[model samples]
Structure formats: structure tokens, C-alpha cells
Target chain A: MSENKKSVFNEIIRPALVLTVITLVTALCLALTNAGTKEVIKANAEKELLRSKQEILPAAEAFSEEKEEELNGKTFKYIEGTDASGEIVGYIFQNSTPGYNGPVTALVAIDTEGKIVDVNALDLNETPNVGMLVGERDFLDQFAGHSGEIALTKEKAAENEVQAVTGATISSAAFLNSVNEGLAQYAAVSGNAPEPLSPEEQACPDAAEFSEEKTVEKDGNTYTYKEALGEDGSLIAYIIRTESKGYHAPVIVLTAIDPDGTIQGTATVDLQETPNLGSKIGEEEFMQQFVGKSSEISLGTLSDTSVEAVSNATISSKAFVDAVNQALELFPLVSGGAS
Target chain B: MSTDKAKVKEVFTRGLIRENPIFRLVLGMCSSLAVSTTLIGALGMSVSVLVVLICSNIVISLLRNFIPNTVRIPAYITVIAGFVTIVQMVIKAFFPEIDGLLGIYLPLIVVNCIILGRAEAFANKNGVLISALDGLSMGLGYTIAMISIAFIRELLGSGTLFGVQVIPASIPPIMLFALPAGGFLVLGILMAVCNRIAEHFGQPKAELGCDSCAAYGRCPAKEFEASQDEAQTDADRKIRKAGARAKRNEEDRK
Candidate 1:
């Protein structure tokens, strides 16, 4: 009986013993390799943050964080930048305000004399075309060198006045509010009060003329007090609305044309399309194609001539064309036949 | 064949293919799925499995003489866990990324049925040399299977195989293949395909002829054969004795 048991051990138990040894050896080698590659990964993350800061404040040679303070019941950071001789070059103030979607944050650069330098949208969670108007260079450039109370309107009542991007009324308002908030904080820290608004500057011309007491009728579209004021205001430079069955949903665009017919601003204030792929229509490149085009230009002709769809993003491109056509139709009415 | 050199060579060759751990024995499927997402990850997992397998097998085989039959499984587990902890600490200090990726799966190798199964069954009864060979082959077989699956999934899903793009830009790469669903789908297809290939190649089934074998009895196989032989002889004697008794009864009646 004992002899029989010995053979069983040789056949069954022996092979199992061999497998265990192989597993143990392999595990030891793997553990060694894993211990070698950790630092490289951490360094890569730090490099990315520095690159983003450089992109936004490219001119400033150096950057330093300022003390945190409360304004309008919200916390903000005042980041100061300096030149080679220790002179203050400019200041990057971080400010946030409630936007259409959520809080929008911006790094507003102000010169030593309290004049606006530039503004970079650090983090914004808002509708693409509607809320993105604040990022436009033309809209933000209006704030440069401005010191007094500012309001967004088409009328040139003061040098500090900023023209709102048409069709993105809410986003424009948010931008004005954040700029005001930033200036207010700067004043409180520097122990000075911001310059008061003048009589003409205080009243929004478009809002005053389009008051609730009066209404206007044009081409079967009823224009009310505020809505009519939006048209009369320089903010509503050009408005166009186009429709095409080619799109999955209706594409509506309201483009603000500068006096020279260049697309100073644009907003896809209304659109329901696929996320990411189709939604890229809200991107800069897509909007840049319309920058210099006139409101009268037919999108159908442009589709064959100028505007081209991004590769693999056909649905979004067609939707953009549809919205562009709609904007073109409303141009004469919104611009008061100026175009 | 009688020399020590010949015995070691025979043992080493058996693990390479004839008794492959993954293909033939079908063991260690947990880490096989978890770390096979990338080739580098698979390589790391393979090395770890090999180290643990070889060390535990060698230790268990050496201690086979002293281990009691009833307490053997517990003893084997303790040895395997010790090596795994050492590997884990060394990895955490040196390679944090891979260490982070492997995470809990590394220590889980201690309970992996393949490791403990081997220690309890083979190493406990075999010589150290044979046990080590078994560990090497099984580990290699598992590694090969894991990398192959990862390669196919990464290529189809991301247009990259092992992080290098293989597909052209014109083709819309299928993203779903990199997800968790793709892992199971790829593994299932690979397993079925392996079985089909084995069948087509006419490989001998490992579990055949166990019944009536001596290995099932005292020797497991020896007693099984002995029982069969005894039954046959008893039947033969009965047939002859019955015939003789019938003939004698016929003579008496006449």
C-alpha cells in the first residue's frame, strides 16, 4: 500500500510543485520593473500646467500670486507680474461670475495705471456660441485702457463703453458683470472708488427706446420694447436666420457684423446637435470662416465656394450653413438696411 | 536516462509545450485578463507571475518531506504570500506607474488557484528541478496568451497596437474595443479559438483513461488495474467450474 502511495505522489503532486515555483519567480521580476518608472509620470503633469499659464500671459516675463480677497461675496486671486527691473508690468486678476451654464472664470490683465490690458478665459462652463462671446478678441479688446464704469451697448457714449456681441445677450451681460467685479475689487484693494457712470452711459439706448410702452412691426415679426432696443443698439450689428432640412435640427445663428462688413462677432445662441463631433461647430476655426464674409452672401453659394465642413464633422457643418443663411435673411432688418 | 543531467533536461522540456500551463492545464485566468490591456503591462504581469511561481515551487518541493498531508495547503499559501509582499514593496519604491496599474492584482496572486494549486499538487511531491521547469513553462504560456489578446484589442480600438498607431487615419477606429466589454469579448473568442485549434490538430486529451487505472487506488493507478485483473480471473474460474459440474450431473442421471 505504501509503495502505491509513492507513485501517486510522483505523478500528481510533483507537477503541481513545479508550477508554483514558476509563478513565484515571475512575480519577483515584475515587482522590480514596476519600482523603476514613477518619477517620469509626475514630471509630465507639472510641465502641462506651466505651458497653459505661458499661453495666456505670454508678454509678462514673470508671474507671482497675489493675496486672496473677498468681493461681492466671492473669493478671487490677484496675480501680479513684473519686468526685469522689479517694476510692475501688469496684473492678472482671477475672477468668476455665474454664466448661463455655471461659473465662468477669467484671468483679467490690468496695467499699473488701472487700465485694462487683456482678458483670458481661464475656465468657463457655458453654452458654446452664446457664452463664448466673452472670449472674442473684438469684444474683449474694447475694455483695454478703460478705467471708468463700463456698460455694454452699441452707443459710443464713453471711451470705456463696450459693445455687446449681438444674439448672445446673456453672455455679454455676464462678461460686463465680471469686468465690473474685477475693477471693483481692484478699487477696494487700492483704496479708491471706481469712476461713476455718466447720464448717457448709465441708460442703455436700446433698452430706453424699446421700452414696454412702445412696439414696432416689421415683416410679420413683432418687435417689442427690449427686443427692438436690441435691434437699434450697435450691439445687434447684423442678424440672420436660415433653415435647411439637411440638418438634424434647426441651426440658428446671429452674427454681429462690424462697420467694415467683417464678422466682428457670432453666436449660435440656439443649436441641438451631437456632442463633441457635431458640437465642434462652436469652435473658433468654424466661426473664423465667417469672420470677413458679408451678411448678404448666400450660404448655398458659399457651401460650394467658401465654407467647407470639417472632415468627419459633416452634420455640424451643414447645420452651421443653415444658421448662417438665417442670419443673412435678418441682416437688413437688424442693421436697419445699413448693409 | 539514469543520470542526473538527463533527468533535469527531461523535466525542463515537459513545461515548454507538452504540458503548457495555460493551453493544456487551463490555469491562472485572473491576472491574465487584468494586466493584458497593454503589452508593457502584460510583460510586467508575466515577470511577476514567473517569479512567484518559481520561488514557491522550489521551496514547497524542498519541504515536501516534512509537511503533513492535512496542513499542506495552508503552508503553501504562507510561502507564496511572503514572496508577493517583497515584490510589491520593491515595485512601489521604484516604478510607481506600473505599480499603480497592477495595484491590488499583484497581491491577489497569492490566492491565484494556479500558484497554490501547483504548490499543493506538484511541488509537494516532485524534486526541485522538475518543479522549477513547470513554473517557467506555465508562466511563459500565460504571458504569451495575455499579450496576444491585448495587441488585437488595442489595435482595433485605438488604431494603435502597443501604443503605436497601425491603422490609417481614413478609417474610423472602433473605440469600443479598448473598453471593458472588449476585454471579455476578446478573451472569450481567443479561448474558443484555442480550443478549436487544439481539436483540429488532434491533440491527445489529458483526462482520458482515468477510470480503472491504478492511479485511482493505492497507487491511484496501480490498485485500479489490480482490481480489473482480479475480476477477470474470478470470472474465468467460475465458467470452467460450472461446466464441469453440469457434465457430472448428466452422467449420474444416465
Candidate 2:
């Protein structure tokens, strides 16, 4: 009887032990891999934030990240960029409001005089085609010169205020809410009533030329490139733009480059891909691959030499390449001089 | 003697058709429904399930003599989970996008009814070779069913099949067919159509039971079997009562 019981134990207990060992080893490996990749993932996220700032404040000389602060009962992060002389160039303020599908977070740049510089949609989770129209350039461009007192009412308003896009009413309203929140905070910080722009005085024609061509000579190499015009007419120096196609969408990137070719900034201007998978291409490590490459370099070469395509992000990477190629081609046209 | 071997082969072949995991047994509805929205998703899911099922069956059969009856379910689950984890990690490292699409369903395969049911009913009692065959046949059956459904859904819903647009540009595709509700509707109609075909051919309707159904002891086949046993007992009692009545009547006449 004792022998039979021992046999039963050997038969049953032994296989169970083997199975448990196998499971543990497999799980341990997974945990290890995840740990190994976590840092690269985090760096990728920071790169995206920097890139978004550059897109909205094209001419910002350098960005100074401010601690999160609350003004007028709303929370915001005030990022102020300055030129070589330590003068305030522009302010990139992060704000959010409820959009059609979910919260729409945006970064808006305003000059010292309180004129609209540019707006960048940082994160938007809305339905495709219908609510996604909020990210359209024409729609976002409406908030370019807006100030505190000007209401976002769709009428032909003063120079500072403009109409929202049709068929995307909710997205437009969400942007307005974010802008209003930013203005309120600015008022609190300055300890003064916010300035309002008159209808005739609102539009800043000079601001439009910031994205226009400029000639600059550096290290005996004269390059004519479009300088992103900041609110105060400071030249936005370092920029990099990359585009790749994802499995389900196009990936368009715009990044700022420091003189040394280190990534000064990066942002995903467009992405239409699978929700969780291909969308990860927009993450930091993937975009960080383009950090500091010369703007004169073609995006195709950058894509090849930089980060490998996320397995399913091939289509997205291709689209990104195309967008970058267009941005690179446009560089010469915008700058109008030989680099 | 040759006929006997043929009969054995026929029994094995029946699993591929008359007892298919998807069409006949309808064993793995969760994966079939979730990943069938896109052809690539379906293909990825099928490959993962196939690998897990085949590996688990082989391991279970090889160690059948060792598993204690009391802890058999837990032992089988551990084996299945080991294979599943391996598949998940490999996909994550190499095929992250496909990994994302398969998502939670890949891990859920640890509890897939078709796999566990085969392990318990066939692999435990069979030799290693037959058990492997059983796993392969069932997995293939599942793959075929899934791909067929995905082909239809992707083609009609998005005007494309396997990412290639097959339907003309003029035709307005029914987009909802690619959503969750569409998955259920397509699976239901497909199952019903399959059942109708089986009935027309006079084949016994394959039982519809999921892994969860078996765990809860509420499978339709189990219910049917219990009801049949109860009816037989009732008939036996009635027969004895009739016999008693006839005996009493004869005695009275005598």
C-alpha cells in the first residue's frame, strides 16, 4: 500500500512541478523584456511633448518648462521660450477641454503682447472624419490671433477672433474652452486684466511671415530655410520633421533641431492607425530616432538609419517618410536660399 | 483487416468535419468572434491557438499517467498556460502590432474549451500520436472556420478582403458588419446555417458548448444527457406498475 501511494505521488507530483517551472520561467522572461524597454519608451514620450511645443511656437528660441500652476481655478503648465538675450520670445501653454469623443489637449503659443501665435493639438481622442476635423489646419488656424475678451462666437469677429470650422462644431468649442482657460491663467499670473484686441488691430500680418523663408549663414555654410516665426519675430532655430506610414494610418512628424543636430523638439502632426498598436509609433523612442539629423537630409535616409519600423507600423512609417520628404522639399522653397 | 484500419482513419477524419471545433462543436467562440473582424487578425489568432493547442495536447498525453485525478484540471491548465505565455511573449517581441490586435484573446486561449475538452476526453485516454493528430485536426478546423468568417466580414464591411478591395468602388459597404455586434450576428447566422446543413445531411447536430459552459456544468449536451436518464427511469417505473396491475387482475379472475 505504501509503495502504491509513493508511485501515485511520483506520477502526479512530478509533472505538476515541471509545468509550474515552465510557467514561471516564461513569465519571468516577459517581465524582464518589459523592464528593459521601459526607459526607451519614456524618452519617446518626452520627445513628442517637445515636438508639439515647436509646432505651435515655431519661432520659439528655446523652451523653458514651468511647473504646473493653477490660475483662476484652472490648472496649466506655462512653457516660456527665450532668445539668446534672455528676452521672452513666446509662451507655450498646455490646456484641455472635453471634445466630441473625449478630452482634447492642446498647446497654444502666445506672444508677450498677448497675440495668438499658433495652436497644436497635443492629444485628441475623437471619432474619425466626423470629430477628427478639429485637428484640421484651417480650423486650428482660427485661434491664431485670438485674445481674452474676444468671444469664439462663429460670427465675423475682430481681427483677434475667428470662426470655427463647420461640421466640427464640438471640436471647435473644445479648442475655445482650452484657449479661454489659458487666457484666464495668464491674467492671474500677470496680475492684470487681460488685454482685448480691437477688430482692426487683431490681425498681425507680420506673424504670418514667421513660417516664410529666411537666409542665415552658419560656420561658412549659408542655408536659406523657412524660419518658424515666433510671436516676437525671434527665429525658431532647431527643427526636424519626419513622416512614416503606420499599419492603418499616416504618421507625419515635425521636430525642431538644435544647431548641433540633437533633437531640440518633436511632434506628430498627423496619425491615423490602429488604436493601441500602430499608434505606439507616435511614442517617444520611435520618434527620437530622428533627433538632431540635418534638415537637409532626406526623410527616407533618416527612416532607414534611425529606429526600425515597429512590426505593424510599416504603413505608418511609409506615410511618415512621405510627410518628411514633403517637409524637407518645402524647406528649400520656404527658405528661398542655398544652405 | 484493411477495413478495420480504414474505420480508425475515418473516426479521426470525422473530427475535421463532423466534429469540427468551430462549425460543429462551436467550442472557441470568444476568439472566433473577437478576431474575425479582420483577415490578418483572424490569421494571427488561428496560428496562436494552433500552436498552443498542439503543444498542450502533446504534453498532456505524454504525462497522462502522472496527473492525479483530483488535480487533473489544474495540471492541464498549467500546461496550456505555459504554451500560451510563450506564444504571447514571442508575438510581443517580434510582432507587436499583431500582438496588440489579438490582445486579451490570446491569453484567454488558456481556457479555450476546444483545447481543454480534447485534452480531457481524448488525449488523456489516447496514445501520444493520436492525441497530436486530434489537436492538429481540431486546430485546422478552427482556422478554416475563422478565416471563412473573416473573409466574408472584411469583404462586405470594408469592401475589401484580406486588406485588398474586392468590392467595386460604387458599392456602399455596410460598415457595422465589422463591429462587435456584427461579429455576433455573423457567428450566429453561420452556426445556424451550418446546423441546417448538418441536419439536411442527417448528421447528428454537433453540440454547442464553450469552455465556460463546461466549467459551469451547464453544457447543453450535459443537460440533454441528464434529462434522457431521468426519462428512462420514469419509463421503467411505469412499466413495473403496469406489470403489477396485470398480475393483480389475473389473480382476481382466477
Candidate 3:
């Protein structure tokens, strides 16, 4: 009888004992680690939230707890940004709007006077390097100054306009909708409608006059470049207008170069690059890479991750690079003859 | 006493060179390739993998005698997966930065062949101390392989080592090494180098396969075992109940 009981214990009780001990050991270790790190994890999460809020509203030294409210049809979470004295300097609105593939999220900030403080894109899940360029600083930073109606444009921006990322009109429109939603939300909560930019606040706000225009035919295309002077009659910029053959047809571009040889900006007069094989060259994101560049642009980049040849549109991409290089070369001639 | 100590030393040392998990056994190539794009990511992955490997090895070795041969692999994987999850949580809590660097590799560690292979081959048959040594030895070998691959990848591909740039920006870092294609190229050449060095030292070639499976010749014996399971007296039923519990753990694994 005792022998039978011993056999049962060996078969069942001992095996259960070993497994139980192993489970208990693992559980205890995990529990201890969880307990030890609980406070630090909570603190890190809070720190991250405050940091994100502060990033969009740099005028504020701290941020209040998030509070949500409905505006229009969408819901938005807002945090009150406080200065050293604890006065609400601005409101940081956390908002999202559906884009091409996913929701575009942004932290849009507005101050007491209804001017945009800054914008921090929290997430952008569009096409890589193309639609995703909406999250790029050069693009989001376009929303930093203006408030009220923001319109997307391919031509030179007026005071109330923002350039859309090239090859990503849908994503750009979605991002614009997200920021416009934030502005509207600010107006609803603050009960003040911010005014749009004035006519004097155009892209070249200091421009006084355009120089005599000249055209040069180069590489199977015609280049028309001119100089613009400041209000004080000093050489302000060189606006170079040219056309190059894209994969499908010929497209025109107008680029503004600072007299110092740095590109102020590039505007597509017309673009026929994307929807087939996208040469994102005419997009604001690609042109933004050349905004401060003085050297002749090339197809493959050595240093910049922001600069890339648009895949499947290598020919169109090379054509755009050559066009930009041609403008950079023409900048010298325009400035030398500026009077 | 001296012979026992020598045996222990040999078991540990052989994993480092003669049967390195990456270069010798050719295990865990997927992870080693993916995470080796950056030194910090590779180091983070190796450390996390090392933690799970050592913990699971010890636990499995301790429970070795109680587990039935047919249910052993399932039991081992359950324990390994549980530890892998806990390690990821711990990394998230303590070193969230390294946790981010680890990215998908944290979950991928659960499926790493080296961890399961070592448990099946060595730990299940070995003593507790020897099993722990095998885990440590195998883990260190993995670490060596990861760091070497990462060092080349990061330095040449991104012009950085451990996230610090040592190469001048004027010299373009080869972007190929940063991509998956470059990973295989580097892994192949390095494996060849490690092989040559091992040959120079007269290390015996590692025999690779599933020969160490406890149920190696028993694939066709499943029906026989089930019949035996039924015909046995009351004691066998109790053991079968434990095997059922092992199946439940296997379900939890998915």
C-alpha cells in the first residue's frame, strides 16, 4: 500500500513541484523588476509629455495637464503652456486628420495674439521619403508663423499660402487640414479669429523692383533669369525661370536664389513627375534640401539623408538636378550685371 | 576532480571558438544580420539574448528530469518565450533607449535558433552548472560575432562606431553595408575568416543538424507512445496529465 502511494508521488507530485518552483522563480524576478522600475517609468512618461508640449510652444517654460474638447467634427486635446509666472502664454493643440494612408498628427501651438507659435508633427505614415516629407521640418516650419486660412500652392506662395511637398499633393493637403483644424480649434476655444497674412507679408516682402529679364538657351531648353532689388535698391535676389523635359512632357520651374548664391526657394511653375514614377524634385521637400545649398546639386548624395534620388524616376530626377545646376551657374551672371 | 574541472572548461571553451553560434553552427543569422547595422543595436540585442539564454538554460536544466522526452521541446520554448517577454519589459522600464534600439529584435529573440538549439542539445542532458556555462559560453560567442559584424557595418556603412563618427564626412560611407544585402555580404566574409582561423588552430569541424533531439529516432514512435500511454497503470496517467499541461504551455506560446 505504501509502495503504491510512493509511485503516485514520483509520477505526479514531484514533477508538479519542479514546474511550480520554476514558475514561481520567474514570477518573483519579474515582479521585483517591475516594482523597482515603476516610479522611474512613470516619471519618464511625464517628462516626455512635458517635453513634447514644450517643443511646439517654446514660449512656455511648462505645460498643464491635457484637456480634451470637441471642435467642428473632430476632437482635440489641448495643454495650456505657461511662462515663468504661470500665465497661459499659448495653447498647444494635439490634433489629427486622416491623410492618404493614415492619420496625420501634429502639435499646433498658438499664442495670445492668435499667431502660430510653432508646429511639431508627431506622426506621419505616408509614402517613404515622398508623402512622409510632410513631417520634415522645412515643411512643418511653414506653418510656424501664419494663422487663419492656409492654402497649398505650386507657384510662389502669397502671404497666406504654404508650398505642398512635391509628388505628395494628397498628403500635403491632409497635413494642411490637420494644421487648419488646430487653428480653427484655437479660434473656437479662445473666441478670437486670427487674421490672415497681409499683402505686404508676401514671400519677398522686401522686394522693390525686378531687373531687366534675359533668356539663355542651354541644353535643349530656354532659361529666363532676372534680378530683384530690395526696397533700398540693393540686389536682393535672382529669380531664374527655366523649363526641362520631364518623362512625360516639358515642365517649367521658377527658382529664387539669394544674391549670396544660396537658394532662397524653388517653385514649380508646372510639374508632371509623379503618379507614374515620381521624381519628387518639384516637391517642396526636395527643393527644401537645396534651400541653403550653394554647390551644384547631383543625383546621388554623399552626406545628406534628406537628399535622395526619386526611385523609378531617375531620368526625371537627373533632369531636375541639371536644371537646378543650370540656375546656380546663371546666378553669378545676373548678380554681376545687377545695377 | 581535475578531470571534472577540465571537462567543464572544455564545454564552455568549445562554444566560444570551435562551435560559435554565428560563425560555426550558423545559427541566428536573421537577427545577427538585421541588428548588426548599428553597434549599439547589436550590443543591445546580444545582451538581451544573453540574458534570456542563461536564464532559460538554468531553468530548463533544473526541470530536465521531470519532463517527458516527447514534451521537452514545448516546455523549453514556453520557458524561453516567457523569459524573452520579461526581458523586453525590463529593458523598456530600465533602458528604454536601448529598448528602442532593439526594436523588433526583442520579440525576434524568442525565435532565435541558437537559444532553442543550445537547450535541446546541451542543457537538457547537462548538469545545472554545466548548462549555465554552456549558456554563458554560447552567449559570449554570439556577442563576439555580433560586435565584429556590427563594427564593420557601422564603421564602413554609416561612418560611425558605437554611434560616434570616426570617419570624415568627406569620405562617403558605403550605404550598401547599412542595407540587408550588405549584411549578408559582411556575414559571409567574416564567417569564412573565422573558419580559416579555427582551422589554423585545429578545431574540429562542428557537426550541425537535429541529431541531438531527444525524440530523434522517435518521429514514427508517436502512435506507439500514445498506446503505451494508455496501457500503462494509474501512474502513467498522472504523467500524461503533465504532458497535457505541457501542451497547454505550447498553446500559450502561440
Candidate 4:
């Protein structure tokens, strides 16, 4: 019996004992570390949620999550944002819609007057330079101070059509659908029945206008290069609207050019950038340098160059310059098509 | 005493260049290719690997004497996986953006060949301090390689340096560099460059196939090299010639 006991210890019992001890020690160490980090992780998630909420509902100093509410045939969660004194400030809704690439998640805020304060497209998996234009102020700012089922359009405003980004109709529609869903949910919850706009009424902006004689699509967007006729019907110059991707968002530029493709005038239509830094690209002083410059204008390359980069916002300045360069590059293609 | 110091230096410096975990040794290629698209992703993976490798190596070295030979691999894996889990949990809680970006790759570090290979080859046979040093150096080597790959990929791929735009917008960004294929391309080019530099300094040119690789046994490259050596040996050649002659003689008798 003593020999048997020694054999068991030598052969089977010892390895099992060693493995068990190692595993238990590892588990104990992991448990202790997990306990230490659990709260920190939770706090980080809450902080991000709070920041997103605050961006959409600026008047609210505090937020409380209400129970998930069902409205408009979909489930919605309303987060009530309150001021410091506990008075309700506005209602923020979390909604998502299937975008061009994947789901685009949004946080939509509604003031007490039932108008949309703003729509923040929070998490998006949309195509980077194309569908990502949904986050720009041009698209998002249009939703502000608007009430009822918000409509979208691609054509000239007909007292109803809100502009849709060129070449990214699907993304624009998906984002608008998310906003409309939030409004429907808000209406259901607050007992206010804002009339639902029919699906056909959600008009996306069109490329062709009454005066557009020639139009072509390039780089997933439509461009119409035509002569800007004077009052006497004589050809003045060429004008084109184009888009370019910046460091954080897209910037749209409407550039007018000579018939020979030299620059005439350039103005930014939509720009969402870091207020003081990247936004410096939009200053008249910075833009004026490109006024009479040729298509070959270079920044920071040649000593006697026509353009200078915005001091700290090199990327924004570059993006702005690139957009103008693209318009100049496109002039020949469009003019050739016209000839 | 001098020899001991030199030996220690060799062990530490070896992982940096001569036996780098990514470029030279070619261990842990999965995370090297997958998580190295951006600087943030690369840094996150490098730090996590550093923690797991160091902790597992120390623990395994301390327990080397008692673990049974038959169960050593399983026991080592269990230890490595535990450390990996702890790293994963801490990262998940603290760095959610990085955690989301790293996603499934963080948990996949448990199976990373470098951590397990170091345990089975070096840590189990060395002292605790030496094993710890090996882990730290190898981790640093991996970090350096990952950063180089990510820097090129992000710059050309997104026209950004560490998420800051560096490349002016005049040049169109090559979006392919941000993808997985770009990771492989950058790694190959970087490896070739490193080999060229090493050759210039009189160090041996880096070997390309797996036979000379330092992973645990059963390497196909190693097996192929062993067979080639056997064919080249005088005795093996003589024996094959004699066997052929014997077969011919038997046929003549028939």
C-alpha cells in the first residue's frame, strides 16, 4: 500500500497537482486586476456617451436614459437632457439606418417646440470620401430648426426640397430616414402627431438645373460645365461646382473660370472644419490669392508660388487648394465635351 | 564574468535585429499584418504583446522545474492565455476606441507564435530574469517593426501621419496601402531593405525560407535542409551508389 501511494504520487498525482496550482494562481491574478479596471472602463464609455449627448443637446447639463419606447413600428430610446436645475431642456433620440456601406448611427435632438435642434451623425461605416459627406454642416445644418418629417432634394429648392449631396444619394437618404424615424418616435412619445411626409415627398437634390445644357459624372459625382452667359447672351466664362475631401470632412467649392481654363473666381459653399484652425482656409484673404492664378498654381513648392498654406492648418489649406485644382483639371474635360 | 556579460548582451540584442520576432525570425506574423494599418493599432498591439510575453515568460520560467514534460505545452498555453485575457480586459475597459479597432485581434494574441514559442524554447530552460529580458526585447523588436510598417501604410494609404495629414492633397492617396495586402507588401519591402542594410555592414544576409526559422520543431524548411544535407554527405552518397549497384547485380543473376 505504501509502494502504491508512492507510485501514484510519482506518476499521476504530481502533474495534475502542478497544473491545478498554476491555473488557480492565474485565475486569482486575473480576477484581482479585473476588479481594479472594471469601473475605469465603465466610466470611459459613459464619458463618450455624455460627450455625444452634450454636443447635440448643448443646453442640457445632465441626461437620464428613459426606458426603451416603441413608436412608428420601431423601438427607440429617449434620453432626457436636463439643465442644472433639473428642468428638462430637450429630448435626444438614438436611431440608426442602413447606409451605403453599413448602418449609420445618429443622435437627434428635439427642442420643446418640436423642431429639430440638430442631428449628429455619430457612428458611420459609410464610404470615406463619398458617403461621409453626411456629417458635413451643409447636410446636417439643414436639419436644424426644421420640424415635421424632414424632406431631402437634389434639385433647386421648390419651397420643399432640401439639398442632397451630389453622388451620395443613398447615404443622404439613409441619414434622412434616420432623422425622420427619430421625429416619428418623438411624435409618438410626446402625443404630438406631426404629419408624416409621404415617401415621394422626400425629394433628393438633382444635378440638372433649368440652365444646365451639358452634364457629366466624374469620380462618382455629376458636373455641368457650361458658359456663364452675360445679359446680352455673350459667353462670359465657365462655372462648375465640385467637392473635395478634407482632413475631417468634405469641402464644396464653386469655381468660375475663363474660357481658356484660367481662374476667374472661387468661393466655398460648404465647409465643416476646426473653427479657428482648419476653418482659416475659408478666409477671403486666403482665397483671394487663387483669384487670378492659373491652373498650375502650386503651394510650398516653387519659391515664387501664387498660394501660401494656412499657417497651422496645412491639411485644410491643401485640401482647399486641391479642390480648386480639381475644378481646373475638370475644365478641359468638360470644355472638350462641349466642343 | 566578461563572457557572461557578453552572452547576456547577445541574448538581448539578438531579438532586436538578428532574430527579430517580425522581420528576421518571422514569428507572430498574424497580428503584424492585421493590426498594423494605423499607428494607434500598432501601438496598442505592441503594448499588449509586451505585457503578455513578459508576464507569461516570468511565470513559466519559475515553474519550469515542476511541470511534467508531457503536459508542458498545454501548461504553457494556459499560462500565456491567462496573461492575454488580463491584457484584453484592461484594454477593453480603458481604451474603448482602440479596443474597438483592435476588436478580435486582441483576443487572438493568445495564439501568437512569439509568446508560445518563447515559452517553449527559451523561458522553460532559462532563469526567471533571463526569460523576462527575452520577453521585453522581443516585444520591443516587434513594436519597432510594426511601427515602421504602419507608418508607411498610413502615410500613403490615408495621406496622414499618426492620424495627422502630412502628405499634401495634390497627390492622390493610395487607398490600397491601408488594406491587408498593403501590410504584406510593406513588410516584404521593409524586410528586403533590412537585409540589404545588414549585408552592407558585413553581417550575414537574412535567410528567406522557414528551415532556418526559430519556431518549435517540425518546420518544413528545416526538414528540407536536413534532407539536402544528407544527400550532400559522402557516406550517404556512397551508400546510395552501392544500393544501386546491388540491385543491378541481382538483375544480372536473374
What are the TM-scores, per candidate, against the unseen true structure?
A: 0.41, 0.52, 0.58, 0.65
Across residues A195-305, which tens digit of lDDT does each residue of candidate 1 receive?
543222222222223222223346786532222235445443333334444346765554544344445445564456677776677666676667666644433334433
Query: Interface Cα RMSD for all candidates?
Result: 10.5, 4.9, 3.8, 2.6
After aligning candidate 3 to the native by TM-score, how far in Å is the CA of A112 from where it should be? 3.5
On TM-score, the leading prediction is 4
Q: Residue B6's C-alpha lDDT in candidate 3?
A: 97
lDDT of 4: 0.79
For candidate 3, give fnat to 2 decimals: 0.19
Residue B128, model 3: lDDT of 92
When candidate 2 is compared with the true two-chain complex, its DockQ is: 0.07
Error of 1 at A255 (Å): 42
Looking at chain B only, the TM-scores across the models are: 0.72, 0.81, 0.80, 0.85
Q: Could you tell which candidate, 3 or 4, scores higher by TM-score?
A: 4
Which 10-residue window of candidate 4 chain A scores lowest in summed lDDT?
A: A198-207
Better of 3 and 4 by lDDT: 4
In candidate 1, position A266 carries an lDDT of 52
lDDT of 4 at A222: 79
Evaluation by TM-score, superior candidate among 1 and 4: 4
| Candidate with the greatest DockQ versus the true structure | 4
User: What is the C-alpha lDDT profile of model 2 across B1-254, one tens digit per residue?
Assistant: 89957756754665665566887776888889878978999999999988888888888898898676666788788788777877776676566668767878999999999889888877787788778877887888788789888988888777787778799958967766776677788887887776666566556544544422212242446777779989999999999999999999999999
Estimate, for each residue in B226-254, the C-alpha lDDT of model 3 and write its tens digit: 67767785678889999999999999998
Give the native contact fraction of candidate 4: 0.58
> Model 1: what is its DockQ?
0.02
